[model samples]
Target: MTSSFLQGKKGLVIGIANDQSIAYGCAKAFRQQGAELAVTYLNEKARPHVQPLAEELGAEIFAPCNVSHPGELEGVFEAIEARWGKLDFLLHSIAFCPMDDLHGRVVDSSAEGFKTAMDVSCHSFIRMAKLAEPLMAEGGSLLAVSYYGAEKVVSHYNVMGPVKAALETTGRYLAAELGPQQIRVNILSPGPIMTRAASGIGHFDELMHHAEEHTPVRHLADINDVGHAAAFLASDAARSISATTFYIDGGYHAISG
Candidate 1:
């Protein structure tokens, strides 16, 4: 069931750490739908894990984009400009908080940890958006990943919850700001699944089981599910869609108890 819905589109994907990463899943889907891709790895340590996936995706440009690193993000965009001259879409799927801060109460999180979380998980997207803006001269989509905890209280999702909330709000503002340029921005919030990042969360198994049990569909979304949504939103088919959040959770977010 491969489709050409995304044929001729060119996109950049950031935050792919390994095969199980949501970024990998979405990038896979985009390739399946016939889009050209440029993918980023975090660093040399992450390069081995991510480069193989980038090869599989047939990415035309593979570069490093450690947003925290002084000039890495800019270098990535510079590579994109040299290689493709333009970008049709961009995906920001990275988030982080030190495990200590993540497992502790939000109020107890150190100022440094909070700032780090916000800078990486939230502010990074803003930076990405700014870098991706001029490259998207033809009006394109910008997307990022989110979680239910951003809007509600989810155990073990402390600092990231607020960080993700900031990300969602940032998406809206970027959408409004970039809409005039025909650049669309949106957020995708998925239920718990065992991502490498998720494994860092305290009581994550309990969280996953609880989500599956309480979810009306009696299951949780895998990376593929989120990927398909990302594919749809990134396509020309979703041209009119922007500045919104799509929950990929299986009815769990709607449950009362």
Candidate 2:
């Protein structure tokens, strides 16, 4: 269970906010399974929280990448190109919606809010995939994080629902477009967890409680569960898998209630 499934693999991991971030969990799992990483911090304010985690994982390239900053996203790939030369996989776990839009109904979400959410949460993955394609000389994986709300209605999950829906669909299309080159693309849909990102969602505690009570597993899945699943999907072990909305949600997606 702890073999070097990803030994020798190298790639960038964007969106690590802190030790509790889903990206951090996945990066930790990737490291434990022998994959070297290039991690990013959003800004100087986030640097302190993310620096130690990146160092703990022995990340080879730790850079500041606020995707909204012009050229910052491209700069991440550039650094990776310089340090690793080639990449095997990438994990994208960033999403954003203005607090007002996140708390408002989808129908009432402002055009700017919807656009901003889609741009950060969905389009960013496509951008990363496009940048990563040339570097993945030997077939590789491109993973994005999603949520069950993308498929079904969840209380207080407003604008992100549509944003994630777009994100999942984009992954499928990227998988198709990049499949010929042997670049596998997929999305990870995890159940509610107390992430800083999730804190933006209104009444998040109720969402977590609902997931814990209703999900068949009788508990919410943690970031580590997402990490292990992400590691497997990104590893050679999942070479044949692509364009999937892989769920690490304790089977909550299976419940219709």
Candidate 3:
């Protein structure tokens, strides 16, 4: 709640679509903590949804970017350079999988779908970090969202589970490579939360219910829970922590039930 923690900080939040988005929550929380914000929308369809949110947040920079496109990624960094000169934080909350692949068994996942999932979910983070590293002259924090499915299979999570596993592995590698620069790379794995993307997964309601029932907190995590965790990890408070994946699943990952 106190803005002093992030006073004078600047950040870029990629993948905000609407208020319900985890990225949106992180953006809002970062702003409340006094961080200047910039946002990226994937395409024209999402622009309308993200623009108003950016406006509300008083974001100085709003750009259209597709992580799959190297040109777009370069443009985003260029825009950030033009506006802020340097970046203190980056939030990567982007992932994708074909709707058909999301409902099928992992064995049924097509090679193309699997590749697309890995490109979007896993590789993009690495690409983003590579691009952001130079701009983080004084060192910075990079945060990405993963899921419990990365380590344990969740029904219908399908190709995304593998993508997340790869993402976690990438995070560790990046942390090691970037630690000498004082740049931190970490993944936050949150339990099921009702987001636009979650709706596409089969039997999402049942998954939510199961998570809540089994978690020690007896409740599923909300966007704010994720947002706050991200803020802390992105802040000086977590300066010593790196090469780790923090589970924000309300202790669900530990429960056998």
Candidate 4:
């Protein structure tokens, strides 16, 4: 049954590269809850894959938004402003690490590679918050994806781990700054899901197996698990929840042995 918790609300979904993406899952949930959406693809190559999903979600504004690309992020906001004049929520799920840096020890990771990873994975979310602030005059929810590796040393997680830690910190600070305006910022740290982005991490199959065995649920959290939580955060139901990390890991983080 279609829900109305988000009825008459508008949201922007960034970082969906394909149907399997976490962003896609969130967008699907948002639409099911009756929220109007604006979705963006990273670039031309990503457009073909993401466009159909946007259409499926009935996104009214679909644009290209590779934050690394100059003006692209702003263009997406402009499109939203033109169509909806405001936003109720935003999701940021994109991250990156040069393969060499990602596979190497964090200590050996080059300064330039570290900078690039921080820029794309951590800083991009900050940029989006800046753009979304004005459009969220009525206040809004801003969500980003992080991981267990941010808080613990997952073997082979490498440079991206530190980058994710930064992301979590960034979210908290943004939440504190934006709270007075009623704009909530929160982070979702999902357990291993085999999205295209997750494929970059080394020994990912092993990580999945480990997560499956260790989690209290004895399985990984699927995209739907994430989608539902995101919907709640974006809704008024979670109005008091902000500046926190929701670990969608099926109790894996709870395991001690």
Candidate 2 lDDT over 121-186, as tens digits, reads 998888899899899988899999999999998889988988899999999999999999999998
lDDT of 4 by residue, 1-257 (tens): 36599998999999999989999989999999999999999889998999889989999999988888899999999889998899999999999989999999999999999999999999999999999999999899999999999999999999999999999999999999999999999999889999999988889999999899999988899888899999999999999999999999999887875
TM-scores, in order shown?
A: 0.98, 0.98, 0.97, 0.98
Q: Which tens-of-lDDT digit does each residue in 1-257 have in candidate 1?
A: 35599988899999899989998889988999999999999889999999888898889999988899999999989998998889999899998898789999999999999999999998999998999999999999999999999999888888888999999999999999999999999999999979899999989999999999999999899999999999999998999999999999998889975
Question: What is the lDDT for 256 in model 2?
Answer: 81
- Best-fitting candidate, scored by lDDT: 4
Steric collisions counted per model = 0, 0, 0, 0
Ranking by TM-score: 4, 2, 1, 3
- What TM-score does structure 3 among the candidates reach? 0.97
Off by more than 4 A, model 4: 1-3
Local distance difference test scores for all models: 0.92, 0.91, 0.90, 0.93
For candidate 4, the 10 contiguous residues with the lowest summed lDDT are 1-10
Clashes by residue pair, model 2: none
Give candidate 4's TM-score.
0.98
